[model samples]
Target: MKKLLTLSLSFVLASTLFIGTANFAHAAKAPAQPAVSAVAKTVKQSKSYSMILSALAQNDVIGQFDPTEITANEVGALINKVTQENPQVLYYKSANVWSNGKIEFAYSLPADVMKKNRVALDAKVKKVVASINKPGLSELDKVKAVHDYLVLNTEYDYANLQKNTIPADSYTAHGALLGGVAVCDGYTKAAQLLLNKLGIENHYVIGQIGDGLHSWNQVKLNDNYYFMDVTWNDPVPNRPGIIAYDYFLVTSNQLRKDHSWIEKNWAVATDKRYSYLQTGKTAAK
Candidate 1:
């Protein structure tokens, strides 16, 4: 985790590949995070990852930025990183073109589709944030509040996705937060946004399950960091109001049973203080 701290944005910039939790459906564990002084500074400086993310948060293509601070390639990386880190960044799907120092991102939803859905999406996020923003909520309490809301609200959207019909931008936060029906990508991205909003540090985890790509979130709660795969907890074909702590908070050793990601890509999950079952407050199912 110290290695992660050395990097700008607290290793916030990484390829966090997210796939539907179909293949690795029955998986779970979680951990906590270190302090946020370093990350807070990075966010304050308008660092590369957060900078490009802020640009796309407006729900538009990339326009301008300080060249010296962010490169075209990094812009592409930021698109994915931001999508995983901030759920509000449900606008563009992926980086379309990054040439001549001018980066243009592709939209997950077409202009017309975005126009119709943007208002509703914004309203939903606002409402959720308000509910999660109550005073006296501890960082962990806030994290749980956001996590429960996501698993309760979102279901793995297999039908539209398998049909290749884009009812909403399932590839981004809009799909997860607004539609309440997203696969792993949607669940992971939604948690990323909510956790960050609650002031908890987090980053995306991209890895492979079998032959397919998959993604989930690694959150930093106070001085201890852990992992949370909201997608894995919310069962597929989801029964409403059934939230599982199976994957609520576990260490990397616990997660290795079913998940794999490039170790060099992000911070290692070593903290076990917040692991759901380990804590004794939540019994293992």
Candidate 2:
């Protein structure tokens, strides 16, 4: 009778342990999946030269700075002309057009500057591009996806801004993701680059905000313009304890209060119907 009782007690103890293990497994949380929008699409891989030409052609005035007018030497200097033998990327310099003697087209990095920063920038671009599985995404959705990703990944590094070593435009998406910190300009430019890759229309606006120079983005979504400030959305790096969204999705008036921009820098819509918020106040006739 004592031996029978011992066996029964052992079986009860084993049953209790098994029940505890099942409860713990059920309570564990799963990893969060990336929240992709309906509009996200995959980016097509293009040859280096093709990508450069495509960017140039898509610019507002390619005819003004005709490629044909440029000499072979100038073309070679401006474009690396990627070949099998020379796998390394090349830098291109801005040239003068017939009418506008020294027209500054798109921004260019000097050969030395490119050489110094190329490795860092390339690694950053590759990583950020690889993060999203952009397949069959619409233009508007692509912009939103990038905007969301930036806000979620990067935090504002106010100390970096204080040092003035890193600007808002300097941070690429990859850097922001890996480092979790960036200045305002870096946040804006990184978002712009990724959105452009997805064929979304966006503009980088640099201007004075309050007393200091600042940078932000104006993206065209569904035929309307909306402002996004990723830097302000992320947590302040030095003060990670706090998070702010004062500037995430702001209206023109709100932006105008703190940010004054040169009219030429922005592609202001003529109709005013495309403005994000209407106050019933019209521009001077």
Candidate 3:
């Protein structure tokens, strides 16, 4: 009886051990990762301006600009100039004109109209442009130039903040340069226009950030991508002036920390440093 009992006990213990080992092996196999969708996947692995333009065009968000109206040689020259000086002032003509002898670009508005509306913004852009000397710059330099210009010239107006009143399309470079005050959309639009003239492919990204609607820019440089937020970079009203560099040249993950973009329109970035910002603090792992 004792020998039979010992044998039976040994068998039971062996079976339990085998079952435990099998369960461990099963657990060790990784859970199947969720598949990324075609739309959700990034178009370019890096943050180049061309790649950014391609992505924007693919998404159908960039507003229609008559390609024929833009001269190729002029565009090339502008790009070269921007890459060299990182100028705050950009050349603008109502219609395309190639000749270089004292070109006077005309606007129908009265001489004092800009002064009455937002004179400071105009002055600032002009001053910055005159100061910049770089041309044919990389996308990163373009972003930095705009970012610095905005920071130096603008201030956030909390009292004027309205959900729907912010004008996006009308904010010209002259306006932003002079007043140093504009809605998020205004800041972004002006940046887009200036960058476009420089032959840098940039997109005016409209999305939600925190509890408010916001507009920003995404630029491509050297086959890589980065985000720029001129509005957020500006100092808050009635505060010691400080520019927020957090949004400058940041990845999508870093932006997710304080801002949330639409899933369909969000541009994925190759830089992984900010990826943790996307998923809350859980990304710490």
Local accuracy of candidate 3 as per-residue lDDT tens digits, 253-283? 7666655566455457556543332231111
Per residue, candidate 2 scores C-alpha lDDT tens digits across 130-151 of 6654677666556556766776
The digit string of per-residue lDDT tens for model 1 on 1-285 reads 111111121212112223433432421111112222212233422665655666676656654445566554444444445544566655554444333444455554577767667677778777898998998888888878888888777776656645545343555566788777675666777777767666778876766554445667787876776778777776656677766676777788877776777665666678777654533222222
What's the alpha carbon RMSD for model 1? 8.4
**Each model's TM-score, in the order given?**
0.72, 0.49, 0.48
lDDT of 3: 0.42
Error of 1 at 196 (Å): 1.9
RMSD of each: 8.4, 24.7, 24.4
Residue 178, candidate 1: alpha-carbon lDDT: 77
Cα lDDT for residue 75, candidate 1: 48
Q: Can you give the lDDT of residue 214 in candidate 2? A: 56
